[model samples]
Target chain A: MSGCRDWLAHLVLGLGAALFLLPIWLAFCAATLDPAAIDRGELSLVPRLDHLGVFLEVLRHGGPGVGPVWRMLAVSAAMALAIALGKIAISILSAYAVVFFRFPFRRTAFWIIFVTLMLPVEVRIIPTYAVMADLHFIDTFQGLTVPLIASATATLLFRQTFVAIPDELLEAARMDGAGPLRFLWDVVLPVSAANLAALFVILFVYGWNQYLWPLLAATSPRLDTVVIGIVKMIGIDTSTEWNKVMATAVLALVPPVLVVVGLQRWFVKGLTEGEK
Target chain B: MERRTIFPGWRLPLLLVAPQLLLTLVFFYWPAAEGLWQSLTRTDAFGIHTRFVGLANFAALFADPRYRSSVAITLVFCAAVTALSLGSGLVLALAADRELRGRDLYRVLLIWPYAVAPAIAAVLWLLLLNPQIGTIGRWLVALGVHWDYALNGTQALLLVIVASAWKQVSYNFLFVLAGLQSIPRAVIEAARMDGAKGFHRFRTIQLPLLAPTLFFLVIVDLVYAAFDTFGVIQAMTQGGPGRATETLVFKVYQDGVVNLDLGSSAAQSVVLMGGVILLTALQFRFLGRRVAS
Candidate 1:
């Protein structure tokens, strides 16, 4: 009976994992199929190579007012960079100061930053949009990038990383006539490279995958990220072209999927190994 | 090296924190405060005209049947997704905990969905479940169970819940697997020696040890359901045939963005934020204690 139960559990787990990954695999398969074939409701497990032309069409055919894939890629890369860089710079500096210094409101500042975790961007979407409009930043890259620049989670993660650094390292740098700025640049950053890499993957993936904010902020097609673009490709009309949508979906997923697969080791370490 | 603090002690920390603080103050705190203020007032299109109506917006939202339905839907969605993800995640973690072949392959395949954006997930599922040509829909029809998310509200809700749950199961599995791996083999062996096996051993020994990880996952899952799934809903059903899947966050987006009812939208946001804050605090207060113990 015990052996039977164990086998059942294993079977169930394998089935569950297959089901969980089905949609992703199916979407990719559908993306590679010809629109005519898809429209005919032909369900083929293996996507035919002849249907690969849809990718080229999706890239070349600027549907309606939609920009080219290269333009969309540029905008997404630029906006993602701005947000990631701004967030990392601020988080690193703030974490450095908080970990090293003993200043007034030190504890209070830390608490405030931590509390922001509870106050997610979704909660403040309405007001944040209004603020963007007020600042005349609506539909601009700055609007998309600025509101997300200060991530409480990143700050907390960086602070945890900084706190794990040995105190003796900083002290030794101090004794060797290294100033705070020099010490941070020379000693601290080197030791924290792994942590920073981990955080970089987390932040980069996050900024890349961000959707609602860009959706709300970027009203025009000009500023749409790959996410919003793929969503828009879902089509408001009932006769929505499933093949085109799937093709666009495949394109949108490629960058972040590649990033995750490439930096997966650091990503896993950042999430799991950090707490210890 | 000398104890000569560079340029007054407060200057450095302040400067260090300046960028983040400024960004947060401008983007987060200011908007949060403005949202509170807007919830109590009336605002016009183009956001130029405004009037202080004071609690009328809140009163209207509370009195509306749609708001009430949204509250119920949001609760059901959050609860269902949380239970489904956590239960499946725990089972998968437990199964994967054994020295099984192809373990790494299973792990990678299981987490593959986590890499897909929620918008894409919704889109993919909608295609697979479409009434006419959907692969699953065709299969269901073949099995004699007529399943059409477009026509059936319960089916639509269940589909959304499943989609969201599937997207997150990987994350939960990752955490739970970590937690399970951390448990010493001696404990399980000791339990087995005491005649604890199968469900008995799992329930008493493994579950107790897994509580901390489970607690963390619950909080994280709640937040994701509430805040993160908005895009999914937007892409999947657009709140559906008759407001069936109109979650609070989706409602807020519809009101603020689509409908242009900024005042009511702000009111909804405030209420949503209040509920989230309450839920988070309750989780920390209750499960946090258990974990600590």
Candidate 2:
């Protein structure tokens, strides 16, 4: 009876995992096939190699309203870079201060950042949009990237990483006539390289996948990221050409997918280290 | 004796914190404060004209039947998604916890769903389940089971819930797997020596230690459901089939963006924020203390 139960459990989990992976596999098949083939449902399970031209067409011809699909790629890449750099720089510095210093309201500030995890963009969209509008930041790069730079998660992770560093390292640097900034650059950051790489990949993925904030803040066509572009292409009428939509979807997913594949090690490391 | 400085005092902290502080104050805090102010007023989409109605918007929202339904739906969605993801994630973590063949492949495949954007996930599912051309719909028809999310509100709600839960299981699984691996194998060996086999070992030795990871995951998943999946709903159903899937965030987006009723949307935002804050505090008070130990 126990053996039978264990087998049943294994079957249940294996099937669930297969279902979890199905949609992503279907998406790849859909993206690769010819539109006619897709409509006819000819290649339902397996993709035909000959129809790979559709992806190339999407890359070359571009989708409706948006220019060449490559333009969207450039936009997403630039935005992701800006968000990653901004988040990391600010998080490292803020984490340094929060970890090392004794200040008035220090605990309060730490808790404030921590609590912001519970207070998400959905809860504060109205005011954030208002600020963006007030600053004339709407439809600009700053509007798209600035708000996301203040990530509580990154700060929390960095603080935990910094706190784990031995105090003697900082003390030794200080005795050697290293200023705090110099010490941070010379000693602290090098020791934290592994954590930094992990955080970088995580932050980059976060920026890459951002949707709502960019949708609200970016009003101009020139500033649209791949996600907003794919969503806009879907159209409220649902009359969008599925071919182009899938093509755009493929485009939007590539960078982050590549990042995940390339930085799989860093991603896992970040997850494990962040939990610690 | 002079207090010798180990590092430069004040300057480093100020510099390190300045950028994040400026951005947070301008973006997060300022908007949060403004949202509070906006909730009590009457305003247009563009904010060109505004009048102070003093809680009238909140009163109207509270009086609306849809708002009441939204609150209930939000709670149900949060609960269902949290339970499903956590439950499935734990099972998968346990299955992969052993020295199985192809374990690495299984782990990779399980986590691949998380790589896709939620918007794309919604779109992919919609295509797979569209009443007319959807693969799943055809399969259901083959099996003599009627399935149409567009006409059936329950079907639509269930689909969204399932999609949200599936998207997050991998993420929860990653953490749970890590937590499982971190358990000292010595403890499990000792349990086995005492004849704590299989379920007994898991329930008595494993589950208790895994509680902290599960607690963190539950809170994180709740927040994601509340905030993140708005894009998915917007993409797939648009809260359709008579507003069955119109979650709190979806309604907030609709009011603010589609309907262009800024004040009411702000009021909805405030209510949602308040609920989340209260729930988080309660979670910390109840579960967080136990997990911390």
Candidate 3:
């Protein structure tokens, strides 16, 4: 009976996995097929491995109204890295400041960052766009990344991690004659390294997956992240390059998927713990 | 909770926090204030003139039939997406929680969908459900089903909901699975000894204990369906087939960005801001003690 139950569990889990993996598998195969065949509604379950050059073809020159895949991927990578690393850097300092030092108005500073969490970019789109325009930051990399780096999530997570560090650690550092900066560099950072990695994966995915912000902020095709580029590729139905769209779609998901999968343990840990 | 041991001088700490403070003030607070101001004021068709009209935009928004429908659409969308995603996530989490072989591999496969961008998820669904080029879509057509989301309003809404929920299930699954694992083993064993088995045991024993996690997920999922699924809706339906899928967030974008209706959009933005704040406050209010413990 237990064996039967195990079999039932496997079957159920397998179906759930396939529900996700099948669409992607079909997309992979569709990406490799000739564009003419796909247009004719002749999608195959099997990929034509020899036609895998479509990935490179799309990478070099994208479909109508879309920039090169390589550039979008680069922009996305840069945005994700900048948002992740920049957020980590600032959040670490700020969290460290709030946790370690007894500064005046420190709670005020923390509350200010916390309040920003309620105002997602979606709610304040127009005014934020206006602000971006006023700064002349529109259609620029700074426009794409910098404003997004001020993350309350990272700050809060780091604060949580820092607060849990025993008071003895701080005393030991003080006893060793190390300054705050040195203690942070040596003790604080090393202790929070795992968290940093986890937050990196989460924020990296967040930055890479941003669509609405980049859609309104960056008008130039050069500033298009992969997510925005794919949307544009499919926007025009007149002479839609189905194969290229599929290839670009695949390209878009690969980096973030790889990051999440490679750091699966930390990503899961951070996601559940940080959010709740 | 205040810390006991601390670094003394305030200057270093203030310096450390200044960058985040500056960015938060300029980007977050300023934009929020601008949205508030814009909501209360109107701009002429020409870009030149602007005047404060005091609640006029809000009054007009409430009076507009389209805005009311958008609100209804948003509520329904949030509800459906939350239910579908959370339901499937629970089932998957439950199935994976058993000591079955290769459970770890099942988890990795199940959770990777979290990484798929909402826009990319839309594109993938299009590849499956596009009437002409889609594999299953073509099959559905051959089976005499009217399967075009592009032209059909109901179909379009369904597609966006599924696509939005698809991208979110992994998040819910991670949380639900964690919640399941966190339940004490002794309790489950006691339930088993009480002769409760399989579906009966889950319904009575596991389900009740999972309430807090479920409550937390509902709020998160509602917020996600409200805001984050913009990419999904924009890519999939563009909230079209005659405004069938246009939730409140999409309406704000369409009015503000495409039509350049700044006042109405700002009003909608303020409304959304209120909704988010309420949702967030409720989450913390209900879940604060749970989180603390």
Candidate 4:
């Protein structure tokens, strides 16, 4: 009976996994087929391994209203890295100050940042664009990244992590004549490495997956993130190269999916715990 | 929650927090305040003249049939996406938690979709569901189902919901799986000894215990379907088939960015901000037990 139940479990889980993997597999196969065949609604389930160079071909060119796939990927990578690292750095500093120091209006500062949780870019679309315009951040890389770096979630998580540190540890660091910065470097960072890793993966994916903000902020095709670029590629569907679009979709999926899967343990920890 | 042993000076800590504070002030607070201010005022088409018209934009919005329809569409979209995603996630999480062989492998396969952007998810689904060139869509056509999301409003809305929910399932799966794993085995064994088994055991014990996680996921998923699926709508339908799939967020974008209707758009934005604040407050009020710990 137990053995029979286990098979049922396997069947259920396998099907669940297929719900995700099948679409991508079909996409990969479609990417390998001829574009005309795909446009003719003849998508195949099996990939043509011989024609796998289409992924390379896609990287070299752009569709109508789309820039080079490689450039978009590079833009996405830069934005993701800047947002992830910038958010982590500043969040760590702010969380450290909030947790470790006695300061005036510390609570006020924390609450101000916390209120941002209520104001995602979705809610403040036009006015935020206006602000970006005012600062001359429109169409610039800073416009794409800096405005997104201040994170309430990362700060809250880091503060939670930092608050759990033993007072004795800080006393010991101080006894070693370590100043605040030194203590933060030598003790705080290393102690919170796992949380940092978790936050990195979460924030990296967050940064990579941003679509609306990028669309609003960067009008120049030069600054198009892969997510934005793919949407543009699909916009002109009549003139769209189907196989190239599929291949571009495949390429776009690789980086963030790799990060999430590679750091699966930490990513799960960060997501399931931090978000709640 | 402050540490007992603290850093001595106010200066260093203040300096440390300055960057985030500044960014928050400029990007978050300033924009939000501008949105509130814009909500109360009107601007002409050429951006030349501006006048204060307190709550008139909001009044106009409520009176507009399109705005009312968008609200109805949003509520339905949120409910459908949340229910579908959470339901599938619970089922998969339950099956995956059964101590089966290769469960770890199954997990990695399921969890990676969380990384796929909402826009990319739309493209993937479009490849499968596009009646002209999509694999499954053409299959549906061959079956004589008259399936074209482009021309049919209801079909377009359904497609958008499916795509949005598909990307979100992995997130809910991760959380639900964690919640399931954290349930005490001893308690399960105790229930087993009491003759509770399988579906009965799950419904009676595991499900109730999982409420906190479920509640948390509901709020998150609703917020996601409300705000984050803008990309899915943009990429898939552009809220098309004659304003069928246009949720509030999409309409905000449409009115504000595309139509350049500053007053109405800002009013809509203010309303959304209020919705978010209300939702967040509700979560904190009810889920304070879990979040506080």
Q: What is the TM-score of chain B alone in each candidate?
A: 0.91, 0.91, 0.97, 0.97
The digit string of per-residue lDDT tens for model 3 on A19-96 reads 999989988998998888999999989999999999998899887888789999999999999999999999999999
Model 3 sits at a Cα RMSD from the real structure of 1.2
Question: Which one wins by DockQ: 1 or 2?
Answer: 1
Per-residue C-alpha lDDT of model 4 across residues B66-91, encoded as one tens digit per residue = 99999999999999999999999999
Model 3 TM-score (2 dp)? 0.98
Worst 10 residues of 4 chain B by lDDT: B284-293
TM-score of 4: 0.98
Q: Residue-wise lDDT of candidate 4 within A1-276, one digit each (tens)? A: 889888888888889888899889988998899888988888888899999998887788766678679999999999999999999999999999999998999999999998786457888889999999999999999999998897787898888889889999999988888999998999999988878888898889989999999999998999999999889888885688778888999999999999999998877876676663
* Shift in Å, residue B199, candidate 3: 2.7
Between prediction 2 and prediction 3, which has the larger lDDT?
Answer: 3
RMSD (Å) of each candidate, 1 decimal: 3.2, 3.1, 1.2, 1.2
Q: After superposing candidate 1 on the true structure, give the runs of residues whose Cα lies further than 4 Å from its correct spot.
A: A1-10, A62-65, A273-276, B1-8, B44-49, B283-293
**Positional deviation of residue A44's Cα in model 4 after best superposition, in angstroms:** 0.7
lDDT of 2 by residue, B6-39 (tens): 3546665767677777777777778888998989
User: What's the lDDT for residue B149 in model 1?
Assistant: 74
Model 3 steric clash pairs: none
Question: lDDT per model, in order?
Answer: 0.78, 0.78, 0.91, 0.90
Per-structure clash totals for the candidates: 0, 1, 0, 0
